[model samples]
Target: MKRRTFDKLVSFVGLGLAALLLIFAGLLNFGANFANDSVASQLENQNISFPAEDAMPSETKDQLAKWAGMKVVTGEMARDYSDLYIWEHMKGSAIAVMGKPATYSEVSGVYMGLVRGGSTDVEKIKQYGDLRQTLFMGNTLRGMLLEAYAFGTLGVIAGYAAIASLVGGVLFLLLGIAGLMHIRRTPEDATI
Candidate 1:
């Protein structure tokens, strides 16, 4: 091929690579957004309440104070009183307080567990119930899997890796068309 043809090929390759990158970026963004939305939906659907009250059981306070500096709180002891659990419980309670129509399928089970545990005080029961994990079950894993699935599904539907892929394809197609027209108009330019 002549110099002009070679240059055109190089330009096309560059465009294609840039498009691929943009598409991937879009996929990442969409995945993150979808995962967040899913989490919010699950929280709402499961009726997991939050914790925001002056009343905290001694056990809960001890546990929470221990893990207050950490972002993630798991394991047996922390399960009862971590901020994560409190946040979930508070949200659920807030919904009830607001008189919103929501109910946990496991409400009875939760109450029974508290009763069996001999924690009649609402604050104490809320603190140690370990119900958050149950309400938003497998939340972390679900978020990751959801993101991957959403990105993959979008990739197939759009014929690109991400939402940005569409833009990439459009720009690529336009450039290709323009280049082809330029070449046809100056076929002799290739020889020069």
Candidate 2:
């Protein structure tokens, strides 16, 4: 085959792979949004409180500021069958954040404005909201926590896809180049 013909074929394959990546990335984003919506709806039907800006209180806000300042440990905590991993898992990312951790205090108590996780046990959550109403009683931090959690989820997914795509995309691009080189060195009459 001629060099131009070979180049065109390589270009076609490259464009096809790029198109597929575009579709894959779109689907992943769509799925994430859908999941977030469904979980939110379910929580609402259950009458669970979602944290919001208005739900926050001065005391809880201060506590959150403190928690943010504390040395955050990013290691996995024993929760259930698999340990609940810390918010960030990027190489050294969690550790660095922990190095300057968010602050909290047993004294400042609870405040509203925190979002709840669908996966978190409802009962355990109530303990924080209902039972401890006397100690700390506001809805502010809950929403803030939930929002932070959602962002963490997004970061993990995007980071993994980015890393994997870089590896695969580079490998495929190299393979396409190698195929072109092979065709160039071969005689015109030789079969591919």
How far off is residue 135 in model 1, in Å?
A: 15
In Å, residue 39's CA in model 2 sits off its true spot by 21
For candidate 2, the TM-score is 0.37
**Cα TM-score per model:** 0.34, 0.37
Candidate 1, residue 73: the lDDT equals 18
Clashes of each: 12, 32
Residues 1-192, candidate 2, lDDT per residue (tens digit)?
566576658856975675566566566656555544544444344343313423323334433332332232211101100111122122123223234322233222321322233435555455344433422222233443355445446645765675566556666667666666665666765544
Cα RMSD to native, each candidate? Answer: 12.6, 14.8
